[model samples]
Each structure stands twice: as C-alpha cells, then as structure tokens.
Target chain A: MRSYKDIHNILLDRIKGGEWEPGALVPSEADLAREFGCTRVTVNRAMQALADSGLIERRRKAGTRVVQRMTRNAVFEIQLVRHEIEQRGGTYKYLLISRSEEKPPQKVRAEMGLSGDNALLHVISLHFADGAPYQLEDRWISLDTVTQARREPFDAISPNEWLLREIPYTNAEHVFRASRAEPMDAEFLNLGEGEPVFVIERTTWLSDAAVTHVRLVHPADSFRLVTRDQHGTAL
Target chain B: MRSYKDIHNILLDRIKGGEWEPGALVPSEADLAREFGCTRVTVNRAMQALADSGLIERRRKAGTRVVQRMTRNAVFEIQLVRHEIEQRGGTYKYLLISRSEEKPPQKVRAEMGLSGDNALLHVISLHFADGAPYQLEDRWISLDTVTQARREPFDAISPNEWLLREIPYTNAEHVFRASRAEPMDAEFLNLGEGEPVFVIERTTWLSDAAVTHVRLVHPADSFRLVTRDQHGTAL
Candidate 1:
C-alpha cells in the first residue's frame, strides 16, 4: 500500500524526469489510482499536495497540467536605523542636525497626500555606526495629525524614535532606489559629490491621515537589504 | 457615553500629548473606567486596541506603558524580468548569451551549500526593453537537483521562466545591493566600467536540495524595487 508521500515523490520524479512536459496534462486521479493499485482518494491527496506546492494546476474538468509560469514572491523588511547598525556589531549614535516647522515642498506634500498649505515639522538627522557616518535621514512629520509634535523638542531623540513611541501608523509605503549623492547627502555622509548612494523613501499614515514621510540615504557600498522565504512561506 | 473607539482616540491623544511619556505606566483599567464613566471591559478593549497597533506594552503586573521602540516591516516582491519590463510599458525581449556546464566558483558553491565537485549548468543572458539593454542575468542550476535542465537548451526562453514552469522550490533567499558593474556586467548592461548598478542575488531550493542560484544586474537609473503595507498588514 503506497502512502500519499510515496505517490508524491514518485510523481515528482516523473515530472522532473520530463516524462510530462510543461502545460501537458497528466493522468487523472482515477487512472493514476488504477495504475498504482490505490484508491482514488489516495491519488487525489497526492495530486492536491503537488498542486499546493505550485508544481501543477487542477481545474474543474480540465484535469491537472504542469504549471506554465510560476510567480514567486520575495519579501524585504524595513529595519530601524539603530537596529540595523547594532545588528552589525557597531555602536550606534544619533545626531539631530536641524529641526523646524515649515511648509513642506510641493513634491513632498504630493507624496504624503496632503492638500493645502499645511506646515509640517521638518527634521534632518544623521546616524553613525562606530563614529562613521552611516545614514542621512530627512524626515517630515505632520503637525496636523501629531499635534504634540509642535511642542516637543526633537534635539535629544530622533524624530523617528519619538514618533514611533507616540504614534501608531496604519499604512506605510517604501521605495528603494540607487542614485548619485546630492550635495547635502554627500556632505553629511562623507562621500564624493557624485558617489552612488542607496536611498529608501518611506511614507506612513494613521488611518486616512498622513503621519510622516522620510528619506534615508546610505553609502551604497556599506548597506544592503536582505530577506528570505522558507518552505514557500513569505517572511 | 464613550465607545471603545472614542476611548481609544482619547487615550491616544493623551499619550501623544506626553501626559504619559514613553516607558511610563498609565492608569489601570479600573482607574480609566472610572475616569471615562465606562466599564472596565470597555477600557480594556481600548487598551487592547492600542497594544495591537504597537503603541503600548501591557505587562502582567507592570501595567501598560507607551512603547519605546516600534519596529515596522516592509516587504519587496521579486518579479520576473519579463513581467517587470512589460509592467513598465516596454516591449520585453530575451537573448541567450551563452550556456555551458562547469564547476561553479568557490564562493557560489559556498552560497549554494554544495560540498562536492559538482558541475552545474551556467547560463548568461540579457533582457531588453524597447530595444535597449535592461538586465543581465547570470544563473547557475544544480544539475544534481534539476536534472532536466541538463538537456534543455535555453535559447528560446529564459532559464528563469523554464525552471519556474518545470520545478517548484520550497525555499528562496534574496539579497539586494548596489555595486559598481564588473567588466562583463558593464559590457552586457551597456554601462561605463565601474558604474553603479543595482543587483539582486537569489538562491532557491527544492525541499533541502539546492536548485538554482542567480545574479541579476541592472543600470542604477533604470531599476528599483518597491513594497507597501496597509492597515498594519504586510503585503
């Protein structure tokens, strides 16, 4: 008596051996059961297992055929600057370069979905790992949504840390790109004027209200984002 | 007269207003119930909502306090080259540069966790969008695990597409970085020598057996990877 696992492995071998080409239909459960001297339920279980692994597709009456184009997903996590540095065995330091309440640039307002001439709290900060310039953070916090930000002094703690403790966002978007360092970014990150830099732009919202928008710039050679998936589960 | 949501917002305002600083314990449920003229259960529900959104921490005896460090998550999807190009409104094209079976380099072997003198199928290909070079794909398929790849000539279709349709991987790892293009990558990607390039390295396995490892390179100005999250759900 062959277990479903046995049938699964046997069918997997046959598929990998090219006995059935991609998009080609395989034997139905009833026929497979008869050939293997097993019940149709056992054969169905084996087929279902294969389908769940993305190897085959089963239609209502079209039977099972080898999948043609499989789409695999990869996930990357956005980490805090402090955590990223500490995880790399470096002492982390935060420096607040400037903080002011002003109307954000038109581009930023558009990105944050803010209409009207609303003033936001603008903050510029630098993060260091072992005394070396690591990340340049340009952040804007909405004073309308986070009213307490108006009275707070962000000199001691970074706005990122402050906001995380004070607000809970319901939506977030992240964009990762590579670009030549602008003058300000080059000056702060200690890089050549046109050196390549990796940039992450993030916008977060609390319900329908915008919370904050930030751009983190890092020296391209020193930073990378990694993520993994195991057993077909996204991480 | 306050509902859970009303209490939730009120508590949020007090926290944001710094009435209770981060790491500071707030009043207990009974106390908050008395203050808000609500049942303890209602207050508890409001507190639970705040905790669920990562705003506060509730301990058995330590009580609830504003959260100190909130770690957010971002997810990036690894898409097929053809699909990526098409999604950008360009005509996608694939060209096979070379294909051969050879012993992979030590670094690649280490990355794949292969410990023996194994010969793998190596493929070099270029992807074009709207008649311009878009990406360079350097891939190695373990002939030991993906035995059918040994006979498949990847001239008509990319090895990525062929393998996805033919095999199902149980695990995958992706690493994203920015690097200066090497000589071969420079030539294939049509970039100046040592120009910045965005790179993605991926390795996939079937169960515990390694199947393929690939490196994809693109011009820094042409490509980026974006991801999003909504309502606190990772996408």
Candidate 2:
C-alpha cells in the first residue's frame, strides 16, 4: 500500500517537474485517488501537506491549484518581557509610567476594529533588564471586552502579563518595523532622539472581540529576532 | 469518552490552577493513563499537545513537567521581493549592482560555517517597485555547493529567483533587526546615512552544507512585516 508520505513525495516531484503549471488546477482528490490506486483520504492528506507548505491552494468549491508564488513562513516567538530578560540572565523589572482610560487615537481605534467613542485603557510602561532600560510599551486595552481591567491597578503587574493570565485570545496580529525613537522611547529606552529602533505592534482578540493592542519599542542595537528551522517542510 | 482534546483542556486547567508548579514534574504517561482511565497513547497525545503549546516539557526518561515561561510564536510569511511589490500593485524591477567571486568577509564566512579561504559568489543587487528603490540585497552563494553558479551570468535573472528555481534547501534561518544605513546602503537606496532601515538576514542550508547567506535591507518608512492569525493554536 502506498503511504501518504509516498504520495506526498510523488506529488511534490510532479510540481517540481512542471507537470502542472503555476495557477493550474491539479486533479481532484477523488481523481488522484483513482490514479494512484489509494483511498481518497490518503490523497487528501498528501494534498493538505502540499497546501500547508505553500505550494498549492485548495478552495471549498474550486479545485486545488499550484500556487503562483512559493512563499515560506518564518516563525518568531513572542516572549514575555520578564521571561526574555530572565532568559538572558538579567533581572527583570517592570515600571508603570502612566495609565488612563480615554478614547484611543483614530489609527489605534481602527486597527483594533473599535467603533466611535469607545474609551480604552491606555497604558505606557517600561521594562528593565538588570537596571537598564530595555523596552518601552505603549498599550491600549479594550475595556469593553476586558471589563475587569478597569477596576484593577496595573502598578505591580503589566497589562501584557495580566491579560495573558486572565484572558485567552483566539487571534493575534503582529507587525514588525523600524522607526526613529520617539521622545517617550528616547527617554525610557535611554536612546538619543532620532536613533533607529525596532518596534513590534501586536493586536490580540478573543474570538471576534478585540482584547488589546500594544507597541513594544527597543533600542536598535540591543535586540534582534532570530528563528531557525531544521526541516524544509517545517514553518 | 475522554478524547485527547478533553484531556488537553483538563491538563491546561491543572497547569493554570497551579496543580503542578513551574518546573515541577507532572505524572508520567503511564500514571496519568491510570488516573484518567485511558490508554497511555491517549494521555501521551494530550501531553504532546501541551508541550507543543509551550506549556510543558517532555524529556526522555525524565517524564513531563510544566514550563516556566509561556511563549507563543508569531508567523511571518517570507515573500519574494518581486511578488511583494507586485502584490501591492506596483511593477517590480531588478537591477544587478555588481557580482564577483571573492573570499567572503570573516563574518560571512563564520555565518556560513566556512573556515578560512572559501571564495564565494557575492552578488549585490537592488530591487525596485514602480521606479522607486525598494530593497538592497547583498547575497553570498556558496560556489562549493552551487558549482553551476560559477558559469552563470546573473544579468537577466536575480540570484534570488535563480537559486529558488535551481536549488532545494533543507534548513534555513531568518533574522530580523534594525540598523542605521551604511554609506553603501545610503547611496543605493537613496537614503540618508543615519536613516533607520529594516534589515533581514537569512541563511539556507542543504542538510549540513550551507547554500547561501543574504542580507536584505529596506527603507524604514516604506516597508513593514505583518502577519495575522485567525486561530489561537496557529504559530
């Protein structure tokens, strides 16, 4: 009996061999099963593996087709500030700079998918590694979804830590960019104004409800995100 | 019937409830199987789920334990620069700055795991979108492995596109960071010397043999990497 791995390799070879051109529809699972003399389930498994590897696209009604562009995913782990610092053998510290409930800026509101006139809990904080400023966090929490955050004081615990412990987010978006240090970042991260800084903006949601949107800034020379994959098929 | 998912949820609750403290060993698969009145295979599946979620660690002969740090992965798709520009509704252009076979810098050598005098094909190129400078690519191809590169003149096609079509790599690494533009970057990218830029360094290997190492620099204001996940369990 031909295993799924064998089918996967055979299909991969066909793709590499240009048997099906890019964007061209491949045979249906049922057709492929008959051609390979295997069960449909086995063919489906092989097709799913190809889809996951970014080589093919499968739609509900449309048949499976070769992807026009072969894109690969790079995975970066989102670590807690405390854990990141402690993992580097540095003592971690958190300090709250400011906290207020107000209508977030229009950009943030739109990014969080919030409507008009909704006040979110805005917070600014600094993370320290061994008494040196590390990251400056600017955050806006959706009080409508996380109602308990309104009553809790974030003096001891960061919103990041608290939210992770209290709420389970079903979706998240992360954006990475480079920008000049803002005044607040310059002061908190102890960097000269206009210096390059790495910024990570993240938004998390619990189902359809927005939970939090945060921007973490670090001095450019201090941090880098690295990921390694041992297998070609692994993301 | 106690499915793996049901067991997974119960174990997650136990971890959240502090039934097993961080770094504290949890019961082995055999023990948990007896308590839950299920087969060891079912319990093992649940434990694997927890481990994959960064909530637990499984060691050979040492049993399983709760993790001290909870980390989540953020996945960013690595798209071809040409595809990225085209996806944004711009005409993509490629310009070959220079190409030569020379001994790479010590840093490049170290990164590629090459010792002493290994002459590699160094290709510097610029990618443009709609007549605007987009990204500067500095690449080093291991001629030892990609021996055919020595005979090819990369005038009509970029090394990136050529290699992707020609070779298959089994392992890869990606690093993202920020940096001030060097003079070469400033001259090619039409940016100020001190301007901040987003940089991506990537290396690919065929099993243990290095294939290529590349650094891609983009103007800070023009590019940002974004990824969104709909499911909580996705990396």
Candidate No. with top lDDT = 2
Would you list the C-alpha lDDT of every candidate in the order shown? 0.83, 0.85
- CA error at residue A66 for candidate 1, angstroms: 9.2
**Highest TM-score, which number?**
2
Off by over 4 Å in 2: A1-47, A55-68, A230-235, B1-69, B232-235
RMSD for all candidates, in order, please.
8.1, 5.7
What is candidate 2's lDDT per residue for A19-111, written digit by digit as tens? Answer: 877788999999999998999988997887778667788997799998776566777777888988898899999999999998998999888
**Candidates' DockQ values?**
0.34, 0.48
lDDT of 2 by residue, B1-235 (tens): 8997899888887775567777899999999899899999889878876775567889989878877655777677777888899998999999999999998999999888887597999999999989989999999999988998998788778898888767766568988999999999999999999799999999998767899999999999998999886431423
Residue A42 miss distance in model 2 (angstroms): 5.7
Error of 2 at A35 (Å): 13
Clashes of each: 0, 0
What TM-score does model 2 score on chain A? Answer: 0.81
lDDT of 1 by residue, B1-235 (tens): 8997899888887775667777888999999999999999889978876775566889988888987665755655556789888988999999999999999999889889898988999999999999988899999999999999988999999998888767767678888888788999999988888788888899998778899999998888998777777532313
